[model samples]
Target: MEDETMSNTSEKIAENVLLLAVARLSMALSLPALGFVAYLLNLNLEQKFQAQENKIVAQKESSDRQANLTTARVETVERVAQSAIDQAGKVNERLISVETKQTQESAASERFQAATLTRLDRLQDSIVGQSNAISALTATLQADQDRNRPPPP
Candidate 1:
């Protein structure tokens, strides 16, 4: 009976050592599996970051295109405004020339009127002198005819 008790105690010790070894092996294998899962999560994060960068680049390009279009439109408007200003300047020059010509014509007409008035005054003086001479001659002729007819009494 003492040999039987010793054999049972030895069997229990062997079973406990076997269970401890299995637990240690399982923990060691789980560490490698966890490392693999962390690597896959890092890869997924990198893919998302790259996609966001591409989207930002596309937005910047679109904004640049819009700015270029706006700049071109502003240039066109400025050109049109400058052209209109040039046309206005030309019209102003033409108006000034017309006013100058009109002034010259008016001055010339005034000079002509003054000269005609002076000539008319001289003509009036000559006509008055002629009328006085014709009246004296008529009086002399009447006196001479009356004297020659005096023997008819």
Candidate 2:
């Protein structure tokens, strides 16, 4: 009975020691495993942040390009409108000049016509006076020739 008791006591001690060693080993390994998991999560979060930043940068560049194009388009339209206005003003000026010249020419033509009519009236009066003088001369010559003639039987 004494031998059996001693053997049972030794066996219980060995089993307890084995269980304590397994617990210690697992604790040591779990600490490193947890640290490794944390490191992996940090790396994944950094990669996600970098990708978001790149996407934001690309969007900003595209917006800037669109703004530049819109500005250029607006400027071009303004220049075209200004040029059209300038051309219209020049055309109006030329039209006014032509009208003024036409009015002056019309006035000159009227003055010339009036002067020509006055000259024609004076010429007609002179020709009528010359015709009356010629008639008087012919009657006097006939009277003289009749006085100079000899009587005939």
Candidate 3:
């Protein structure tokens, strides 16, 4: 009877030790799982941060490009406006020059016409005087002929 009691007590002690070992093993496995979960969370956070950074960089680049395009368009418009203004100035100058030349030419032509008319009037007067002289000379010659003619026989 004593030997059977001793064997039963030893069996109970072995079961208690097994229970303790199981609890210790479960705790070890839980630690590794928790660490793995924490690593995954850190990785997800890093990915989100990196994506946001990339978006910000892209936005900056887009803004810079837009600014450059606007500046270029403005410069082109300014150049065109300046060119138009320069062309207008040149046209104005040309018009003034043309008007001056036309006025000068008109004035010179009037003087020339006046001189020509004066010369024509002088020529007409000289022609009239010469015709009168020729008529006088012809009359003298006829008188001499009459005197010199012999009487009709």
Candidate 4:
């Protein structure tokens, strides 16, 4: 009876040890699989982070380019407006110059017309004086001829 009881107690101890060993083996074997899954998750997370960073960089570059383009366009518009203003001023100056010239020509023409009219009046007076002198000479010649007649009836 003492030998059977000792044998039964040893058998129960062996069974408990076997069960504990099997549980430990399963836990150990699952470590690599869990580690592999964790590694894949970490790799995916790193790739996503890099992709987000790349997107942010691209957006910054695009915004910078757009700002530069807007600046260039504004500058161009300003230059064109300045040029137009300059051209308009030049045209106005030319128009003023033309108007001044026209006024000067009109005055000069008026003066020339006045001078011509004065000259014509003087010419008419001279011609009248010459005709009077011719008439006086003819009358003197006719009187002398009468005074020198032979008195023959």
Candidate 5:
């Protein structure tokens, strides 16, 4: 009976050891599975962050392109406006030159007219003096002819 009791005690100790070992194994296995799950979660978060960064970059590039296009358009409009202003200035200069030439021509025409009028007045006075002298000569010739004819009759 004593030998049987010792045997039973040994069997109980062996059974307890087996139960402890099984619990430790289960814990060890579960640790690796938990680590794998954590790795998967980290990968997913990284992918999301990278995708958000890429989207932001694309938006920034699009905004930059739009700003550049607007700047180019504004520059083009400014150039056209400047060209128009230059053309207007040229036209104004041409008009001023034409006016000055017209004024000069008008003055010259007035001077010519004045000179012609003075010459015409001198010619009229000379003609009047010649007509008076011719009349006196004709009267003297008529008197001489009458005296010569009466003495013959």
Candidate 6:
């Protein structure tokens, strides 16, 4: 019985010593392992930040392109509007010129018509005066012939 008790006590001590050695080894390795883990986490964060930066850069480029396109479109629209305004102005000028020319022609035609009417009125008055003079001459000639002839038998 004494031998068995000593043997059991020795075994318990050996087991405790082995557990303590394992715990010490884990504590010794934990610092480097934690540093490695922290390094890996930092690398992952850097990669994520780089990806965000790349996305921002791509978005900026796209925005610049869109702005340039909009500017070009605005310029084109302005040019077209200017062209239309110029054409309208030219058309207005031509219309005014045509109106002025028409007015001049109408005035001349009215003047010609008035002159023709006056000439016709004068011609009619001259013809009426000549007809009266012929009638008076014929009456005087008949009276003279009656005086020259003898009375009726």
Model 5 Cα shift for residue 115 (angstroms): 99
lDDT of candidate model 4 versus the reference: 0.59
Arrange candidates by lDDT, descending: 6, 4, 3, 2, 5, 1
> Where does candidate 4 stray beyond 4 Å?
1-80
C-alpha TM-scores of all predictions = 0.41, 0.45, 0.43, 0.45, 0.41, 0.44
- In candidate 2 the C-alpha lDDT for residue 131 amounts to 47
Model 3, 1-153: lDDT tens per residue?
888867866775576567546645655565465556555655765676576556555655665565565556555555776775665555556555655655565566567557655755665566556555645655565466556544454
Q: How many backbone clashes does candidate 3 have?
A: 0
Relative to the unseen true structure, what is the C-alpha lDDT of residue 142 in candidate 6, on a scale of 0 to 100?
48
Q: lDDT (CA) for every model shown?
A: 0.55, 0.57, 0.58, 0.59, 0.56, 0.59
Residue 94, candidate 6: Cα error in Å is: 41
Which of candidates 4 and 5 reaches a greater TM-score? 4
Q: How high a TM-score does candidate 6 get?
A: 0.44
Give the alpha carbon lDDT tens digit for every residue of 4-100 in model 6.
Answer: 9679767755765675566556555655665565566557656765765565556556656655655565555557767756655555565556556
Query: Candidate 5's error at 34, in angstroms?
Result: 2.9
Cα lDDT of candidate 2 equals: 0.57
Model 5 pairs whose backbones collide = none
Task: Work out candidate 3's RMSD over C-alphas.
Answer: 67.2
- Report model 5's TM-score to 2 decimal places: 0.41
In model 6, residue pairs whose N, Cα or C atoms come closer than 3 Å (at least 3 residues apart or on different chains), thus clashing, are none
Please, what are the lDDT tens digits per residue for candidate 5 over residues 1-153?
989967976775576567546645654565465556555655765676576556556655655565565556555555776775665555556555655655565565557556645654564465455444544544454455444433321
Q: Is 2 or 5 the stronger prediction by lDDT?
A: 2
Model 6: how far residue 31 lies from native, Å: 2.6
Model 5 ranges with Cα > 4 A deviation: 1-11, 81-153
Q: Write the per-residue lDDT of candidate 2 for residues 1-153, one digit (tens) a residue.
A: 989967866775566566445645655565465556555655765676576556555655655565565556555555776775665555556555655655565565557556645654565565456544544554465465456433442
Model 2: residue 7 alpha-carbon error in angstroms: 3.6
Counting clashing residue pairs in each candidate, in order, gives 0, 0, 0, 0, 0, 0
